[model samples]
Target: MRAIAYFKQNDIHFSSDLPEPRIGADDEVLIDVSWCGVCGTDLHEYLDGPIFMPKDGETNPLSGKQLPQPLGHEFSGVVAEVGPKVTKVKVGDHVVVEASLGCLDTHRWPKTRLSCTQDKPCGACRKGFTNCCEHNGFTGLGVVGGAFAEKVVAGERHCIKVSPDLPLDVAALVEPLSVSWHALRSAGFQKGMTACILGAGPIGLTTIAALKGAGAKKIVVSELAQIRRDFAQSIGAEVFDPTAHGTNAAEVLKKMSGDDDGFDFAFDCSGVKATFDMGLAFTTFHGVCVNVAIWGHKPVDYYPMLVTCKEKILTGSIGYTTLDFESVVNALQNGDIPLDDCKKLISGKYTLEDGWEKGFMQLMHHKDKCIKILLTPNNHGELKSAK
Candidate 1:
């Protein structure tokens, strides 16, 4: 098995002789990975890692994994083998992994759901919010082996069957799109409402598409990159260059909203100080502002008076739930999310050998030119589109 592993901060390697994983439990499924998307967390692990990767001397209590763990969470594959008790999917099913690892053993009854059933489950899990389970860790990130390899094994609860007609590469996006879906649902988004997305990165772009599919009446996106702005526009979103938008990007959003009003819901997917402030400022009074990005210890300073005056609701969304994943898959299958537009987000492709230089580095330094890069293990040296 050839897989990418994280050894330390700024250290990741692709090994051709890595040991192959096998199905060890009756509820496990082994997948032949078709495509894996390089995510921001993967980049963070490469540049300033050990953030999520367990310390060299410590172990992840849930997965019991130490350093040098396999690294990839957003992926899709074919079920190469299935444990005898795995009844939700067969050996030849095409599926996208949910990736979020919760109390796998306790949440085994309903294969389609990922909830804890312990007498005293975590507070979040008790509320049916498994994504916030106290012991949660991503499968490829720090729990079980990841999908960056040719094959990886995961519990059947973490695998969601998708339509075989869906392209495998596009199927890799189900996890991230589910993130956006959960964020909107958390913010109480309703049909015919307006939204303002404060970024044009991969997640932000996906948020726009998800909003459209959910029946949003107006979608406004603020981005500094011209290419991303163009991409947002191509998807029927009104985009503005944040850097050139007057003194503050919020002003642009307010004007766009008309009558000096603000949007019904605003999302901060940039994880930056400016974008966070803009999302708060541009949200209508009594509206909701959702933080959908991972901010690594970045302190933000803003007027608390603003929140108090508007009676605004400030909330944050982490991972996705089973319902969120199913909704995105349904949207993709129903043609609500256009395949051609979704394919535009994929900027490049690479093999596991060149994933470091071509995939991670491309996103790190050339973010203006790259959106989402896919990597494959069996398809060595193949750089064509995953579509």
Candidate 2:
């Protein structure tokens, strides 16, 4: 099998001899990948990592699987086979994988080194919050080999079938879109409510679409990059260049709100001190602010009065749950989310062999020029139109 995988820190490449993944349990599924999108986390791993990936010579605590594994958590594919107990979907079904692996999945790897016991799982998982599991990890990140190859296997619980009419390329986006959707859901977003997103990166752009689908009456995006602002506008966000506003930018953002007071919800996807403070500073008195970005280890300055005096809800959201995947799929199916807009997110496509240089490095160097770049196994015929 051919694959683009990560070995140790700063080492990821293509190989033709990577072993094919097999169904390890009776409820596992075998997927023939159609397309896989490289994520910022993938780039982070290549630059400075082993973050989610197990250390060299060490296996993942959840899967007990060693490194040098395939790297792709955002993917869509067709079901090629199903285990004896797999009842979610059968052969030939078009599907997207949920990709999350947590304490609840320890049953699939009885030999794993995690502390999950037969009767007790993580505290978060016990309360139905697998996304916040104590030992949470993702399939492609290190839990197991993922969809960046000819075929990958997962448990039936992680597979969600999509409409045959949905394009496979857009389907691969469900994973990332679900991340934003979950954040919105956590914020208690409602139709006709307004939102202010503090960034225009991949997650920020998807947050725009998620807000629109939830029936937002007005959405504003603040970004410093011209190209990213353009991308946000292409999908219906009212763009703002904070760099132009100087220190008075936060005041200007509040004036643009529907009430001219502040936004009903603000999401800090930029994860910087300035944006983080601005998110709280400009939100309406009782509005919510959700931190959705993967921030660094250093702590940022915070004023207790910013959130305390206003009685605003300050929270954060991580990975998506299975329900998020199902809801996003339904939204795309019912046209609440335009498939054409999803297609616009795709900036390029390449076969798996060339993915590292063309797809990964393209994101590494020329990130502003791209939104999402897809890679394929060439098993499907999308390569004929590859750019």
Candidate 3:
């Protein structure tokens, strides 16, 4: 087997002949990688170094996989093998693996359903709510192997089967799109809402597209780059050049919308403080502000006063849940996401042989211009391991 492994923080070496993963338990299944989408988090790991990867002697206690593992989460592939107890799916089934891997052994039973669903949810698993499962384990980075390499082994529960109509390359987007879905779900978005997204990158655009598909009356995207702004417009979002429009979204909105009032909902997808401030400034009174970007620091600021004054909702969104993932897949299957336009979202492509620094670094520095980049096996097979 071959794979792209993290030898150390900020270092990904390419190597072949890595041992192929075997079916660990009766509930597990192995998938042959088809297409893996490169995400912002992966680029963050490549640039900022590993913070979430498993360390030696620090096994998940659930799947028990160890340190320096392969790093891929958003991917789509075909089932190549199944464990003895795996009956839901078999060989040749095309599936998209969920990035999360919870402690299913404890939560699988109906009794645990109380802890898993709303009311007693502890903030995450509550019916319409649910971000990160506090009690559950992570799938790709923690408990199970990810889909970056030639093969990925995961519990059957994490695999979502796609209709044969959905191609593998397009299916690879299901996880990332699900992330946008979870963010919107967390924010309690409704139809006819006008949203101002403070970033036009891949995730930002995806969020805009999702809002449009859900019947948002209007979407205003704030982007600093012309390419990103153009991309947003290409996808049907009304774009605003925040940098050129004088640091004030109110003024920018007036210039963009003539005399329209503030937007109904605002989302900060840039993960930067400046964008956060702009999102707060442009949102309508009593509107919601959703933070979908991953900010490493304490996201606290004076925005609370603004939030309090307007009685606005301030919320943070995290990774996707099972239902969110299902919604993403269904959205794709129904053509609500538009595969043709979704394909255009892919601005760059790379092969694993180029190594992480080259491909991943490009993502870090040129994010304003690049949308999504897919990392394929050199031969379009398994990803080679680091040297």
Q: Rate the local accuracy (lDDT) of all candidates.
A: 0.82, 0.90, 0.71
Model 2 TM-score relative to the real fold? 0.97
Error of 2 at 363 (Å): 0.5
Provide the global lDDT of candidate 1 against the true structure. Answer: 0.82
lDDT by residue for model 3 (150-185), tens: 888877877888887787777888887887888888
Clashes of each: 0, 0, 12
lDDT of 2 by residue, 1-387 (tens): 999999888899999999999887899999999999989998998898988898999988888889789999999999999999988899999999998888878888966997785368978888888899888899899999987898999889889999989989999999999999999997798999989999998999999988878899899999999989998999999999998888999999998896867999999889999899999888998899999988889998888888888899999999989999999999999999888888889888889998998899999998898889889996565553323
User: Which pairs clash inside model 1?
Assistant: none
Residue 155, candidate 1: how far off, in angstroms? Answer: 1.1
Q: Every model's Cα RMSD, please?
A: 3.6, 1.4, 4.7
Question: Where is the poorest 10-residue window by lDDT in model 2?
Answer: 378-387
lDDT of 1 by residue, 24-84 (tens): 7788899999899999888887777677678778776665556667789999999999999
Stretches > 4 Å off in candidate 3: 56-62, 105-130, 135-137, 254-259, 303-305, 355-358, 378-387
Determine which window of 10 residues in candidate 3 has minimal summed lDDT.
Answer: 106-115
Give the TM-scores of the predictions, in the order they appear: 0.91, 0.97, 0.86
Model 1: CA > 4 A from native: 105-120, 258-260, 380-382, 385-387
